[model samples]
Target: MTTLRTLTACFLTFLLSLAAAVAGKPNIILVMSDDQGWGDVAFREHPVLKTPHLDKMAAESLVLEQAYASAPVCSPSRASILTGRTPNRSTCYRHGHSMHPKEETLPQILKKYGYATGHFGKWHLGTLYKNSPVNPTAAGYDEWISAPNFFDIDPTLSNKGVATQYKGDSSEITMRLALDFIKRQSAAKQPFFTTVWYGSPHDPHKALDRDKVGYEKLGQHKANFLGEITELDRTVGELRAALRELGIEKETIVWFCSDNGGLKNLGVTGGRAHKGTVYEGGLRVPSIIEWPGKVKAGISKLPTNGSDMLPTVLELAGIEHQPKHPLDGVSIAKTVLGQEKAQPHPLGFWHYDVAGIGCWGEREMQALLKLQQAGQEVTDPKQLRSSGKPVKVSTKANSYPGHSAWLDYPWKLHRIESKKGKVSWELYNLALDPMESKNLTSEKKAEFEALKQAHLNWLQSVQTSMKGADYE
Candidate 1:
């Protein structure tokens, strides 16, 4: 009788522990690379620019082949990921725009559910020292070590609000800070939400001498650029190893992706155009999600976008509250878990008003540079106006009359209104031609018209969001 009682007690204890483990929420680690391209990874078959670590990550994780950034620029894409909304909806239509304090960020929402949040690397959303209500901490991160923009080697990062200098490669430094935070969180047995956004391979490209040594024979510029990416990959490996060392590998969900497209001048190892355009080579980036025990290891050609990350993380963490504003992205948890046969969201949208050399036009870039140089910050839309009305800016697209695209199902309809007011449409069956080389617009007139209307509707919705109407 005594033996039976002891056996029963042991069985009950094991069951309870199993239940507790199942009930425990997983930690989230969102790793974003600056100006990385979809073709950067070796697994993606880039002719050059080897990314062994990223390739390994893709092989051991869920790789989303058709993932896109929220915008062609950095800040807007980051905002969309943080807020679970489109760039326009979040009032982050362009680069250097800070996220509003009222917006609920992924870290903030997770914090409410007892997750300790840390943001390391680029925090281009707002100034580090400024008493702005729209700062990263105000947006819901408990601990923040960030740069105002894409930082170079040995960049100075603001810890909380105080500036501190960091040595070595930028990406490695960022990872070190994140690792320290992770160690602390792990020791405390607290779940953590960490964003390790590396400022690497962005322009004025600089890499450590040792890192560049391997590719020294190549052109100085090309060597430095590729070196930064290679170093960034090593940092990722370190972070993964650290997680395993802490015995949290199985309990942590690590998501790796890029902020925008790769740089073309730096040798477009990714696709076509580099950062700053709406082309597939510019907006589409590599994305991998790794969650041991939960997410199965494999490649998912499913299309995922930046806006989808927030919702996906929230759902994975079992958080219930959805933002009052509608989301452009849906939870990709099902796809990550290998439970879904297709992507959660059908269409990924990319829109930008500013036009110039890169994604924005030269005139727009000059204006922005002037403002930054003068230290005259433009935080609010009202501040953009000289008078009472909002400042109106035109783009090359505007000169072309109007340009719009609707990526519906497997078809992408591109409507180009020429300067002569001639409306020309082009259609490409993306399912068959991912490169969008073939134009079937004339043959698919009815389909093109339907998609044009859909694109217009989407534009109207985006416009309303930009005006902050949706938030109200």
Candidate 2:
């Protein structure tokens, strides 16, 4: 006969076991390359760039052919991916702007569920100095080894806000740091979320000696650029192999993408506008999602962008929260899991680089490096920011505009607001003219008008959020 005490003990044990199961969610690894264009991959027909690992991963995963970045710049796109909202919603107006302190981030959300979250490599969303209010830790990462912007060989990084020097290929160094964090978390039986942002293939591209040799046919600059991508691809292979060797391949969610489009002068943007433009070349990127346990090998052309990352990850982890702020992105968990065929909503892209923000991230990082070289502790928070006061955006005069687009598959509408406040619209049937060679505005007046109205409504919503309405 079972005693009453034994029955109570059994019930408690069952409850504890259930809690562990809930906390042991899939490990998430998000890897993004710097300035790697859609055509910069071997599988995508890059004449010189070699990406064997990425090609293999693409074959085994669900590839997104229509993947886009929220913005055509690095900082804004990174903010959108982390917050599941457009960069404007968080006031990340341009390349140097820091992430808003008030906004919730992906790492913070995962932390609520007992996940060990770490950010490694380029953290252009904000300054990575020890005391910056917008540092990775302030943005919800438990621990971070990061740089304020794009870095290269022999780069200086902040290891949990401490300036440290590392020597290696930048891509490989970033991955190794992330892998260390993953190994520690796995050994402790804790699920983890890590972002590995590689600072390769960006400007000042300096590929290692071994990586640049094969690209001799191209010019020196092109060779170096393509070589950096080749190095990045090798690093990808290393990360995947490490995960499999650790026996967590099936239980991990790995995603690979580029922050934005390729360089305009490279002639490698797949026949579209390059980075910083709202055209296909500037926005479109190579993306692959691999979850051996849940998602099958396939391909998707449904339009998606960086803003969808956080929501999709949250849903995948089964964490439910009703956000007070309206989300610009919708979760595509069902699509990834093979339960849905198409994304249910169209994506919006806007680019308005607000000037005169006076971002001090570069200055702060340089100072930190100097202090480190002098063997001084980088503990002064004031040194990490542009101003001594916490960074804040003025909510006045929200009517600023630049280029905005409404992308709804088969059709796209672009609204360009000139500096003089003159507005012009262009319409393109993407299916018929993927190159956007012909404007359909005069022929498809009805469709153009409808998309124009839709874009206007979206602009109003975005501006409202920008004016601090979202927090309320």
Candidate 3:
């Protein structure tokens, strides 16, 4: 009788602990748009575009007014989001570089805690076919419908490992796939992490006819570009509405942002130069997080970045496992909850001057699909979108080439290294000069010297990481 009583109590305790853990795990959905800028959304005073749904989110959620992408490009920023580290640490030096399989990914860690994870839309990290190391599945996502790069309308996406055709607007198609995953997970009462990476507002601005409704007056190019953004807004509304209808609105956390800053004329960067530069115009992006239960609605100018996503989500989910490698992003959970003002440390960004592997969307996918259906195999390494042979990354302590920047709050320092070995420095107090008009290196000698030394130390650490010291 005593043994029976003990067993009963133990079982009850187990059940209660399980329930508590489940309650703490929120349904996390990270939605990213490719190449959309800080001023692309309607709420940011965009003159022509109308993003009602996103505006609603901005009004009701925690808006990070000064959020930046880890890099000024797509794949590198995605790497930061996946691993909570900078791009080069994960071997993503350029736009189409593959994320290293050795790195610990967010989906992999979340899955250990029984979360159903799915990645949908533009997965520019690597090939979608099973062979690539950083393919969505290999990167730890349980389910994925992704593209090699930026897919467009009626995109031919890789379903699991098979290339398949998906119709409708690009952004909507991506959102619908995520919604399906959310519904299934909700039905099973399982926590989920779904990434709805929209492939719109990137290039070749192909917007649906209906979405082009109010933008006809703006030339054809502008109309199409704005329409793509409008389409994105509608999809955002759809995702939020679906969650509410499913009775899980308060239990979900939806984070929305763009991959990089805007283009020259088509979009607004909200800063100096457009995409590809280390300037605010290239790195600044629209970012918002909506969590009705824990995080209250408010505006915060706390500087955040893509590297912060993984650690932040882990903190929110109460997962305490540390990454086996160095992480550039620290948990900004307090910031999201309006308890913290800024990051604990400065953020680092580098535009590594390496060539990116080119992978087209429809053209390459359609060809791969035909090859797969014909029972043929892709044997060539170039055809497979990877070198196949092992390539060693350079890890010299003094080889910090290209443009790199360090943001330590109101002060930002830029290091420009020319191909001819000429090195120059530019310092700007972003709080005073958002456009980086004046060079304050001469005036702020103390700050300039400190930041330069800090950047050098960081660069050396990054070289160590590149040498596979982190994996060791």
Candidate 4:
């Protein structure tokens, strides 16, 4: 009887330990940079810019080589990250649109599990007005200090609903706010979700005087752009150090990535066409995730995108609230855990309807007005469209010639449709040509035809989603 009692005690102790481990949910910090390119990092072979901090993080984290932004611009990519749905489905295919409040955001989902959620820096999804249901607070963030758009140095941010001034480099200011939130959450022994979205390396590229001095020697605008990226990198390093000091480094999952591709006009190119274009250079960006005890260090060649983040985080937090709407992204928890060999999804999609100036152009504005004027009964006006079907508009072929691309397995196709209805297609075997230099549409007509149809099909699906259809 004594031996049996001792054995039972040991078993109970083991179960208790296991329960403690399971209850210790991790703190999540998602760090996003604005307009940063895939090749901006010093470790990525940019000759002049120095990003030692990011380089170090990459060395110590899971580096995703082919990570892409869901959209070629800011608002859409960010929406995808929050919703785990395609930008079109989220009604955020444009640069300055708002995400619907009815949809659950990553922070909101985590909040149900007792995570203190805070969002700092850029919050371009929507306005911060109390009437706007798409603001940070409406989306489930408990504390928010954010801007409606890209802000430079010494920016003004809306704290919850009030505007406040913050001095110092934009990146640093954002990081400071996040660090403060982290400290508070740590004191309470509560898990936290903080998103530090830096508005650097975008337009009017401004860096601290010291940061610009080293690049001034290069004597080019590209050098200035590089300086901004370096400054952003430094801020990231500072945040990571803070987490370590708080004894949370090993228990925190820190994800670093860009909102979209680089700006070519700034002389920083990713591969082809910059910024607004749909080329890989415009959509692909650098991404790294560091969870000291959980994610194994090394490079992951898997083709991941911004949409995958929400599902991954939900899984990590042990929250099983599947989104009410169909999600285009799959949880990459297996890949993060080193149990998967390849990406879980078969294909990724990208699409945009408003031409030239992006999805939020005059055309889209007019469309919104028309919807309002027609008294179209919308369950969620903030959503792209409650029906998931594209509003039928006369589409002129080749209306947006700047850049557009579709990637399916080994083949990638680019459709550059100009303003005059002239559509030109460029095809590249991504497995063979990552740079997308060769155009094989003429040589491989059949393959080109198949890919073209696929691209159109994707556009159709995007249109459907915009109408607010529940697309899986």
Against the true structure, whose TM-score is highest? Answer: 3
TM-score between candidate 3 and the true structure: 0.94
Evaluate candidate 2 by giving its C-alpha RMSD to the native, one decimal. 3.8
Give a tens-digit lDDT track for model 3, residues 1-472. 9999999999999878766777658989999999899999889888878999999999999998999999999999998999999988888888878888788999999887878899999998877776766688888899999988887788899888788898898898998999999999999999999889988898888898999998998888989888999998999999999999999988899999998998987789969998988999999999999998788888888888999999999988788886789888988998887776665469899887667777787887898799999987566666554553223555555878789999998999999987765789999999999999899999999999999999988888887887778877
**Best first by TM-score, ranked:** 3, 2, 1, 4
**What tens digits encode model 2's per-residue C-alpha lDDT throughout 1-472?**
5698899999999878756755658999999999988888998887767889999999999998889999998888999999999998888877877777788888888887778889999888766766677888888899899987888887878888777778888899999999999999889888999999999788788888899888888788888888899999999999999999999998899999999988977736744689989999999998999998688998988889999988998898888877657889888889999997785578899898456243343355667778777988556555466452323544335344788899988898988877767778889988889888898999999998888888888888888888777777
Clashes of 2: 0
The number of residue pairs in model 1 that clash at the backbone is: 6
Of models 2 and 4, which has the larger lDDT?
Answer: 2
Question: Each candidate: what lDDT?
Answer: 0.74, 0.84, 0.87, 0.76
TM-scores vs. true structure, each candidate? 0.83, 0.92, 0.94, 0.83
In the range 342-405, model 4's lDDT, one tens digit per residue, is 6635345555556422222223323434554576522444442323232233333324323456
Weakest lDDT window of 10 consecutive positions for candidate 4: 356-365
Best-first order by lDDT = 3, 2, 4, 1
Which regions of candidate 3 are displaced past 4 Å?
1-20, 340-344, 379-393
